[model samples]
Target: MKRSSRNYAEGESPRERIVNAARRLFGSKGFYATTTAELAEEASVSVGQIYRLFTDKDDVILAIVEENVRVRLAEMHSIFDAVERRELAMFEAIKAIAANSLHNEDGSLFYEILAEACRNPTVAERFEKQTAFYRDGIRRLAALARPDVPAAELEAYGDVMMACFIGLGHRTAMSPPVDPEATSHSTACLMMRALGLAELESGRVQTQP
Candidate 1:
């Protein structure tokens, strides 16, 4: 199973340890710069163990991406649940999701993955698989949106959300911190308005759908 976090405790499985180490090392160093030997050393596992658990460095990166997508989907589901329970407004949920997209360093990892994928066929294939996995997650989220839109409409929402969220990651990495909350709010409003879940009042977006 993919880990929800990178924390490793006593008696953690070798595969889990290896994945966690790879996540950290890959985050700190470019994918091309990190070698299997370094991964083995950081994971506290033998090179043999690394190979036994994963096909190669590409496989390790795939595992990391899969885990990241799983966590994001779970968080999105929880936010939706909160909205259903009336504990969170739909606008608030969108803001939460957008803020999360802006807060992470996934953009750097994304570019690093692209660079590695260009040089290695296996990495390219793995990247494609992980992207499909994330795309499916987005489709599920779109299906769950309020007012029960048609399949084509849901697909459009998912497409817009995915593209904008990925763009936000790049924006976060490139831009200086300038009222992140304001940026997140506007982005959230855009998504909600597009989804037909927002109504404007007093020149401000209402939390309700």
Candidate 2:
């Protein structure tokens, strides 16, 4: 198996430190504007150390994307498990996801990577791969949540649901802050209607503990 890029000497890991610094700088200054020297300074490590951990700035960005994908996949799996166990309602799951998207730094970093993917083929390829990971997870979750739905229809529904969340993430990052609770409720209602679960109105879905 491929080893993690996070290998480090005894004590604090420079790899984690570098990734944290890069995430902040990239989110604030953007991928193209942020330089390796700045990253080294922010990370409190030498430029050589950054190089030792990553091939270059793009590599660092890819590493960040990979980490985010791993985290998101885990969250998706948790949501799926909860839904499968009947511990969480579908509408509640959507609401929880929307609320999380509103305040997370991951949303901003996601947009940054998306912008880079437009001009950089390497970033584009990685972006596509990571995106497929997300979509496949969503497809699985949709299947689990609505097994009676036809497979083709479930696939389409999953794509639309994923798009809604992505759009909400971008809007939350760019627009003025809004009430996450309200946004979640409204979005969940619409998603339920769209998913042909209109019989189960927003009022009927109980929030998971």
Candidate 3:
């Protein structure tokens, strides 16, 4: 693995370095193809250092998955807070989310991890847990948007919304390039309608003509 010119902080620990290296290598070369020696070389640490910090490569992958999940959950909380406080409109938030989901580098990493989860039981377990956490956050956001909707129905909406986001990610990764702005606008409109926010759709039409 080739090292980027960017310097790691002086205080950055070997464990952190190894996990970061694993994220890049795993995302690029894939979990199965990437070897322990490559990971050690990329991190500028000895193979022994990796074993001291993690049981094996899978442990390192899990650590990266956990970190990614934590950061994304925090972002979701921020989005929920903004919407709850009326600092951000629900449609606008959805648009921003769709755009990020399609364009962000981490989006590719997320899909890579999902593929790994299919074969690795440990990764699959952690992935499923993080997915549940993500779904719960979406459910809460839906409840905030539709206070009158029953919890059961809101949960269903969350499931469908997550499916839409995942499908959008795959679509964006396909060969024919996708227009981010158009995709965001259409997804936001679809989600708003699904959430029973007809007023937003009406506002959009009223502004159009």
* RMSD for each of the candidates: 5.2, 6.2, 3.9
Better of 2 and 3 by lDDT: 2
What TM-score, to 2 decimals, does candidate 1 have? 0.77
What overall lDDT, based on C-alpha atoms, would model 1 receive against the true structure?
Answer: 0.75
- Per-residue lDDT over 1-209 for candidate 3, one digit per residue giving the tens place of the 0 to 100 score: 44545477899998988888887888788777898898888888888888999998777877887886677678778887987777877787777767766765555566777777888898899888877887787677677766776778977887888887667766644547788999899998888877767544333211121
Flag the better candidate by lDDT, 1 or 2.
2
Off by over 4 Å in 1: 1-8, 118-126, 143-149, 178-180, 199-209
On residues 43-135, what C-alpha lDDT tens digit does candidate 1 reach at each position?
777888899988888888888777877887788778878766767766777788888778775666767667788888887887778777767
RMSD of 3: 3.9
The estimated TM-scores of all candidates read: 0.77, 0.85, 0.84
Task: Give the Cα error of residue 85 in candidate 1, in Å.
Answer: 3.6
Q: What is the C-alpha lDDT of each candidate?
A: 0.75, 0.78, 0.75
Residues 126-178 of candidate 2 have per-residue lDDT tens digits of 87898899888878867765678778888898899888877887785777878
Q: Looking at model 2, which ten-residue stretch has the lowest summed lDDT?
A: 200-209
